[model samples]
Target: MQRVLMAAGISEDVVSQRPSNRQHRLVNKTLRRLEKLHEACADPRLGLKSSSPYLLELLPETASALRRVWEPYRGLGAFTGPAPGEDEAVFLGLHARTLLAQTDRALLLFKEAKEKMFDETSSYRKDLTKLSLLFSHMLWELKAIFPGDRYHGNTYNLTKTEARDFWKMTFGNKCLVRWSIFAEKLRCVHPFQEGLESVALKATLDLTCNDHVSVFEFDIFTRLFQPWGSLLRNWTQLAVTHPGYMAFLTYDQALSRLGRHPRKPGSYIFRLSCTRMGQWAIGHVTSEGDIVQTILENTPLYLALLQGHSQGRYLYPDGQDANPDLSALHRPDHKAKVKVTQEQYELYGKVGSSFRLCKICTQEEKDTRIEPCGHLVCRRCLDSWLQKSAGHTCPYCRCDVEDTEPVEVEPYQPKHKQEKESDTDDDHEDIELVVKQMASLRKKAPERKTAQQ
Candidate 1:
């Protein structure tokens, strides 16, 4: 269960002398690093691949001082969620507050983190300086543990640009999911310094929102938290209604079998999702001769998916019809399974383009920038739009346009005359049509339009 660190001077302290604040933080940083090394060694699923090039590297000097925590679980079982409860969080906050468990301290800390760190009006959302402050607040001793600590006296901290970009990415889309993804990414960026997962549950309070008391409040999460081992112990104990379920089949194992047998396209079997434990996923052979899988958290039985969705998905390895016996057990509520990214690829050609065309018609040069939503529209087209609607609307995001700005093009001071000639062309029928449309719109006194409503 433990590995003894053998060092001549590193004897256990006889005196109960309290460590200084800086020493405590430094030791915590070291302990965090050691924790990562131990997990890397224990989990073969990781393939010992360092998330960062600098992380998971062992130094001969620290070998004698490093201790290994016993980890018996591997593969699917390895994910024993860090802060599964108040106990785990209490264990983590021990060094600072020895009586953390005796009181409601763990709950308070988690509540504080949820409110101060991840709340909608959090200071990290304000600006870079505040975000950097958060970096220091936690066990993030970035400089001492990363590139800066050893190399050319370098001070490697996050830049304003990186800080701003991180905020946009993590808070840009869905609420909880973005933060979860952000936490995952933050782990890699600073992996060598200290681990993030051990502290993530505390940070996210096991993915609890600020207003909510527990994540178990959500039913989908209830199913998600219960690992597959609890549902059916082994293949022999399979109680799943979906006949396609080849119980406990790993993705690699399924892929190998399908490759060897060479089943027809759309042949699929329901298996435990590799990405999320306890979740049902389809390991199906696609028309493109590839085996693909995606975990659907909400739906337990993929029978509805089998019965309804074509998605090039057929039940069993032989592409046979669904067994009436299995279909009778649990009736599917939804018409069909929700489409995943790969499933949508067959229908959608391209997602989006790099060219900043007007999102309304998707055919004009974006000349006027709408404020708040930051959507761009051609000025003449926008004038007619404002006249008709009598209310400002950003056709792109559907946000009520508050203000407008003319998109200024910096004068192209090209070094070569040939470059200017090469850039300008007469072949743009699309651009000319847009230009004609811009000219035709009756010139309403050129003034900035402001729409509060």
Candidate 2:
């Protein structure tokens, strides 16, 4: 059925007739040219592709037609959309310290991004649109690894029956059978509202990677350092609960699966350990650097270019170059590494002012009280009630607050700034710095502080 569909759509001439090596070469060259166009759009360092007719010829008519639409604005460089910059590094650091672990970083990032970019009155249409595109690209990369006859776009809606059919046809193994069934059922009965498919898609993509990597591994990295948001939460949760048979991981895992690993000292046999599951899944991302090195060394174009250029024959001993070794320069490790662009950082401050409380606070607690009527209160105000209160009255309004029913409140786990508040004026300064720094990183405002009444 798939073959029939392909033949009908691609045409009999293109499907059955295999291209000669020369033809294949031409196609590869064209793909490289297309890549140049993409590269040009991403970074200004690469000169424009318009100068060379050969490069111009490489782009398919369809892509070429859309070239103007894809072009970045003057002075804007290529529109890789908003990314974090050095100024926003403080917030990034705060995130590494705060919600990176035990929470959805991407959602946090997205919320911060949305807050930074848009506002309560501003719909997230633009942010979601870009995010949807990014997610589609990620899915495309995953699909490339696991070839399928039909690719439903990120928006492909599958009925429960169709999803079941998809799984049965794609993966008939017993272990995966249950997963497929569950996924199909989940599709029919999803957790979130009908809207926000794009948001859900991004989260699903991230969650798919997380499941393969294991939630723990991803969480650890995000918690301590990375400062992305969890824009991909609902979809990710859905994917986690009802993932496709194929597991996804970081780009590093894909490289490892392709049989590339770092060469240990004096060991002819490359290490191949037992396939074990980590916090995300039973996959590997530990040796992406080696795979990248191998691809660069083995590729003919790389060698030819090395000879063609001023640089002599060189070997990559370990793949830790701050800059890219190849022309495309989209390194797997670099792409995987989370760094905020300047736009993202500046925008964080703009958006951070929108939310009344930071997104992290929302996940744990938010709007549990109203001011006067049920005035705003943070963990500090509630701490006193921890000792004695079936229901504590609002400190501001003195209204009979019935919901103050404390249930053996756990000891307060001071956030990153709290522990540091004890040191000195410097320490207090540090806490303030951390709070101000987090302003950019957060989508919502920090919980307001108040004395216990």
Candidate 3:
């Protein structure tokens, strides 16, 4: 109950709960030391050390004049958005405690405006674009992704072809990147980081597609979630010799081009499908040296499945070079491998299952895919996150999640059920033997008094 209250911000730990005996003394001592630590700190060492001075070194009159500029916006939060706990944490650092008191005042003012003047209130505002602010030597950037925020307008949006080029050039052919199915049209990165880990699970979404924000199981260690900066790794050079995606070519043209190359059984070429924007047609030579073609879906997993069942081992234009050449997951050092021992399989399954669990609640599977970002999270968690967020942003990635769609995650099958049953039988036998031995031992043992003395 106390923990619940503390989490809800209704009560403090010291007020709702107390340590007994010596533990109480430790708590009081810790508080006293903390107070002393603050008291002994000098004014210069008090807050963040700015690299440069204030941008506006204004006189008293000038400051008042600046305040007057915002007078008209006083009813609309002075043209400000809701506070994100994080922006202040980065801007003021430890000094943000004083800013906390100001938040209540701000909330009260917003409420008073709503009550007194309904028509003038900010509550009815919609389609509010995500705003970013910059100040003096220290910059305060706010990324409060609300329901109607416009990331598509202010971000690096991409078309289907560009996104395809992105993949063919990088780890595009790899199974590890099957998660980037939604980063096609709109762009904005929500980096989820903890500790000093350089690689954070960054989520990107096409905000134009989805109508809501999203959340990801950021703590999941799957390779699918990588630093957004990884997208810049130059892999477009592969297309030069590979000739994988030959744009502006018809089926006959692709076939004509492949005919000129060496008559390798597995050699193939891909041309943009005339029907749709992101679709492609794969023209490949059969084992019998006859040409065959099929439409390729705009999904990495589908392409991977096709490759797995292909007559040729290598990618198009390079038979025997193999699709593995473009896959980082098949590398010797990669955690995910094609083959493993039975023990390794079970161990990986166990670990993978845990990783797939929703880190937010730690009780459900992250089986629902949030649109635009394509982040998998539980419905229960996503709904709860949406309710509490003043402006709906993902708790993990902090992305502007617009909508969610339910998805099917393959259930993990552990190979230890039979072994567990045998172990249980052994445990039962051991328990029976222990009980008999204890009975015999008790008959030969001396009695003892039950009194405290």
The per-model lDDT (C-alpha) reads 0.35, 0.28, 0.33
- Model 3 TM-score (2 dp): 0.26
- lDDT tens per residue, model 3, 1-453: 344333222223222222123323333333343333223222232231221111122112222332332233233322233232321111111112212222223334434554332331243211000100011100111111111222111222222222323433542222111123222212233232243221111211211111111211111111111211222221122222234545345445556666754567667766434332223466777767777777532223223434544634234453434443445422223111112234433533433434355656768966555434455567788778787888666565677654333344443345643443211101011223334545655664544332333
Worst 10 residues of 2 by lDDT: 265-274
Write down the lDDT that model 2 would get.
Answer: 0.28
Cα error of candidate 2 at position 324, Å: 39
| Model 1 lDDT per residue over 1-453, tens place | 011111111112311122223333434455554444344334443233332111233221122222111111112323232221222121122222321111123233334554343332344222212221222212122122222222111222211222223434543321122233434554454341234433433332232222211211122222422222221222112232335655334455566556643447666666544444335566667777677766553233433354434444664443556532433223322111111122122211232321345545667755555543444566667766776874556554556654443442222332433444331111112334444444544242243232322
- The C-alpha RMSD in Å for every predicted model, in order, reads 22.4, 28.3, 24.5
Query: What TM-score does prediction 1 earn?
Result: 0.27
Off by over 4 Å in 2: 1-26, 38-199, 206-453
Residue 184, model 3: lDDT of: 26
Q: Per-residue lDDT for 25 in model 3?
A: 38
Candidate 2 per-residue lDDT, tens place, 1-453, comes to 234323222223321222223323333343344444333333333222242112223224323322321222112322332332221221112211221121233244344653343332233423332332333332332332222422122222221222223334443321111222333433453333445653443344333332121112222222211111221231232133222112332333334443333442110111111121111221211223233211111112222233323342123212222212334321222111112233333443454431223232433332223211323334444445433555545544445542221011122222433343221101001123336657645533343322322
Q: What's each prediction's TM-score?
A: 0.27, 0.19, 0.26
